[model samples]
Target: MKYGYYPGCSLERNASAYHESAMEVAAALNLEFAEVEDWNCCGATEYMAIDMLPAFALISRNLALAAEQMGNGRQQQLVAPCSACFLNLSKTDRYLRDSPELADKVNQALAAGGLHYKPGSLRVRHLLDILVTDVGFNAVAEKVTKPLYNLRLAPYYGCLVVRPVRKTPFDNPEYPTSLDTLMRTLGAKVVDYPLKAQCCGGHMTQIKEHTALEIIRRLLKNAADYQADAIVTLCPMCQLNLDAYQDNVNKHFGTNYNIPILYFTQLVGLAFGISPKKLGFGKEFVDAAPALKKIGAEPPPKAKKPRPSKTALPMPAPAEED
Candidate 1:
């Protein structure tokens, strides 16, 4: 199976591990992902809020590229690993398909860039969707090199992928089952987290620290109640919010929730016997070393700390002298 991959900006930067694991997993699954050429942004949360038409056009422009670059004009698939990107791409296609007025407006914007997107030309899916629905949970189970047996995982859906159901194309609105299925395939017990779809307060963490911490507290609290060893998620944003801010959340809430929030790809890479380095463990703030330790995968080599730049001479322009 061939898919068009959109790594999004974050994956190239903060989520490099996601990109690495995705490649390893794609190889393991025997599915080829040909990245589309020169793809633009998906117009994430910010664009839609600022202006709807151009935002949809930007996302649709990507969809149009995915459609045009399909290996054989077969089923067009865009493997979006980020929930926000997936939601925006999927939402725009769905909305445009149903709303002619909106479609016309978006297409008009596309005209400026000499790009045109036909509604329903392609399908936008989260990485988990492709893993579970396209690849099948059983196939994933068969690839387990080391089962995460007895590891309790809280499958967090975050708000973007499953919420505002009208936009997402995956499973049930209120309850998504992909992550749970993927977890079970890895031989771990999946906990039914009530706060799975609850907002992690996303980028709002910086804008509204207290509220974001509270929201994060709830998710960790529920995961703790279920005694989850780790929180598995599909979005880099959710993982960043929960993992990077875990210390702050615990500090504020007076609770020590030590659960590691891991991208599902990291888990899959582990299960497939890929080295932890390839899975990008060192990049995480809270340190998944101990967590990966529990599963018998050795920790990645400690990344070298950067050396400070040497003192520089003061700027001086030779103007002169005599």
Candidate 2:
């Protein structure tokens, strides 16, 4: 089936691996994705809290663009790989449909660009939702050329993905099992993680790091408690907060937690027999080699190259390729 893919900002840079592996997995599954052209950010999780009208308007632009981009005969659904983008776009669409006055105001703003989106014109969906429901676990399991045997994993949904249930309405917000089931389909042993749908500190790591680390520590501690080899994530924000700050979390709590944080799509790509490098394997701060080795599928470490001169280029945060 074909879909309107909205990769969002993070996927292009920090989560480039997520974008790479997702494209690889979608190709393997025979799913076609036509990216939304000239798409902008969804205003993230912060903008809405700052200003409702502007935030909704910003998000509505993407929906308007996607609605216009769906060329005749293609489905009117736009799938987002980023949780923040999915939530923002879906929330704005739902609200615009629910409120006529707000829709009028947003449409007025879009008028300058010669675009107007009718609420409900496009369906906003998460990549995971499409995979589990449309693709089906059985169909995905059939693609297991290299099942992730002997690997123990904790499926971390974080928040936002399944939350605001009345709006999203697919999985249980409190305790989602879609990822758990997906991991099982890949032949990886799924751990009984209580914090499966828990918050991953999100931007709290930036605002109040101590609080964020505490929240992050709880999730990591639980995975460690269950002896999970790695924690699989659905959101890039969750992966960034947990993976990038893992060392800081360890230092702050005086605890040693090195569980590799991986994108669920990466594992799915691995199960499809895609090389780890192609799946963005070694991009994580906490090395995934140890965990991948358990399944006898660890990719060789990439060779380090000389750093670019400071005057020549600025490095990307959350680690860039060597």
Instruction: Report, for every candidate in turn, its global Cα lDDT versus the true structure.
Output: 0.81, 0.89
lDDT of 2 by residue, 1-322 (tens): 8789999999999999899999999999999999999999999878878998888888888898898989534448889999989888888888888889999999999997898988888878899998999999999999999988878899999888897733656788888889989998888888889989888988898899999999999999999999999999989999999999999999999999998999989999999999999999889999999888898554334467676787865656454311
Worst 10 residues of 1 by lDDT: 313-322
Listed per model in order, the count of residue pairs whose N, CA or C atoms clash below 3 Å is 0, 0
List CA RMSD, all candidates: 17.9, 13.7
Model 2 off-target regions past 4 Å?
Answer: 72-75, 165-168, 296-322
Whole-model alpha-carbon lDDT for candidate 1: 0.81
lDDT of 1 by residue, 1-322 (tens): 8788988988888778788888888999998888888888887688878987777788888887788777334558778888888888888888998999999898888888887778877778888888888999889988998887656788998888766544545777678787888887886767778888788887788798998999999999999998888898888888889888999988897898888888888889888888889888788877777766566343224456555456756655453211
Candidate whose TM-score is highest: 2
